[model samples]
Target: MLAFAGAGLWLLLAGPADVLGIDSGNAGMVLLMTATWTALYQVGRLPPEDVVRVGSPAEWKAWIGTAFMAAAIAYFLTRGEVLAGVTVFNDPHAQRIGRNLVLLLVAWSVLSSVMASRWKGVVEQDERDREIAAQASGWGRGALVAVVIGLAVLLGLSPASRLAWASHLMIANLLIFALMWSCFVEYAATAAYYWRERRWQ
Candidate 1:
């Protein structure tokens, strides 16, 4: 979460021109590759029992959702040239990337849904889970609202020339990033709660 947030901040500070000069698409691909390898290494390190626990249906759902959300935000922001170019809406390559990402997200959701149906009888949520979810949801919503307000204020105060560069695609990407960031925060909070609760138990 911190890494993603940092990347977003870097893009904002560097601006499109700087990002383009630095080849943001290559940077994004490198980051994605690193993340993939890290995930694989962590999974390989898990013991059999730990692997089973991690592979549980509910855990799988959470992992898939988090991964998809992060990937969507990252890919859209980078692959669509939102960081590298003036406007994603006007770039044919960016549009194609965006379409492919949407399709990938939809496919992932459908697959997760199918898996959930198969595991419906085995997977059960308890009061603790519900409490954690409620708390996380509240945090996520609050964070998202704060981000929206902050962006609004910044845009409102910016000069006309600066605002002119803030195209529709840029605004949309900002919102998407905020939403994904909130979700990441919510997941992190929930994970922390679970860790503490387990430690106490």
Candidate 2:
């Protein structure tokens, strides 16, 4: 987990900077957001017996509360800053980048928390759930593989398609994220079932 955190920090510093063309302040905000977001995710995933039940009304309240919390964090992190020096909405590229980042962070937090809550029910899985999970995993894997191949071809042809390269890359990144997320969901479902099965037996 420390290794994972370290890698995330590295990506936030090196990868997001180059991708977003952001300098120090924006980079720092993004890094802080990423770190906090990850921390919240881990907190949400605490074992059912160890933490608040995620699907309960209280947990729902917490999830909504955290969205506001995240918004506050984003505003404070970006407020009165160099990146905000430019008109936030006027520049299409900057606006899109910022919007994507914000939405991604909030949505990740909400969804992860909900899933952690649902994981309690997931612990009671049966054979039907396992079979459905198997199917989902198979389909998700195929789709993920296809997307990777398609993206690779697009990357190879990017030099030739220079006119829309930026747009292509941006969309490609979104699609890659979606595919990765789907694959992860499938794997998580399967793993959860096996874990529950072990506990049951």
Candidate 3:
């Protein structure tokens, strides 16, 4: 899928373009997400005869939208409608919408996960499930560390004049963005691993 590794290259080489009202940076992510859904949804389209392998991905597919939605909320909350430099938390107009959306989304995801998954089963997670989860966990942690280190380098090495827009509030949301990104990475990897196993079947 062009939306995987290729998509990032396309985004970097293409620079930034306008699509409708959104920038290529945002649109590029949507493109990648479309690919994620396209690929991962195929797992369910032809599930193998293994409960352990099929269980996590099927459930993860259901929450892909949730992850994307949460990311969007974070994106919006990280900026002001008039001032991109200020976080929604400090921007009066954007704060209310961001707070309410975050609360509702968190609640919705929790309920959705509980309802969609067969957690009551005696088997719970098998060896395959544990393996996938562990792999995903490692990926998430690595992504988080990379994001943090990158941010530190940018702030530490760059001249203050060059980073004039880096408000305290903005820095705070950047950390939030880092966490969100790591979670998204973990989720994508989990779903991908699950989907990858299905192709052979």
Q: Tell me the whole-model lDDT of each prediction, alpha carbons only.
A: 0.61, 0.50, 0.58
Best by TM-score: 1
Error (Å) of candidate 2 at residue 147 is 1.3
Number of residue pairs clashing in candidate 2, backbone atoms closer than 3 angstroms, sequence gap of 3 or more or interchain = 0
Clashes of each: 0, 0, 0
Could you give candidate 3's per-residue lDDT for residues 160-185 as a string of tens digits?
88987677766776687677777777
Better of 1 and 3 by TM-score: 1
**Cα misplacement distance, residue 174 of candidate 3 (Å):** 0.4
lDDT-sorted candidate list, best first: 1, 3, 2
Clashing pairs in 3: none
Scored by lDDT, model 1 comes in at 0.61
- Please give the ranking of all candidate structures by TM-score, highest first, separated by commas: 1, 3, 2
Q: Candidate 1: which stretches are off by over 4 Å? A: 1-56, 79-90
Q: Candidate 2, overall lDDT?
A: 0.50
Q: In model 3, what is the error at residue 32, expressed in angstroms? A: 19
* Model 2: CA > 4 A from native: 1-92, 95-105, 118-123, 157-201
lDDT digits (tens) for residues 24-115 of candidate 1: 43344345444544554565566645654654544455555666566666566555444446564667655645554565466556656655
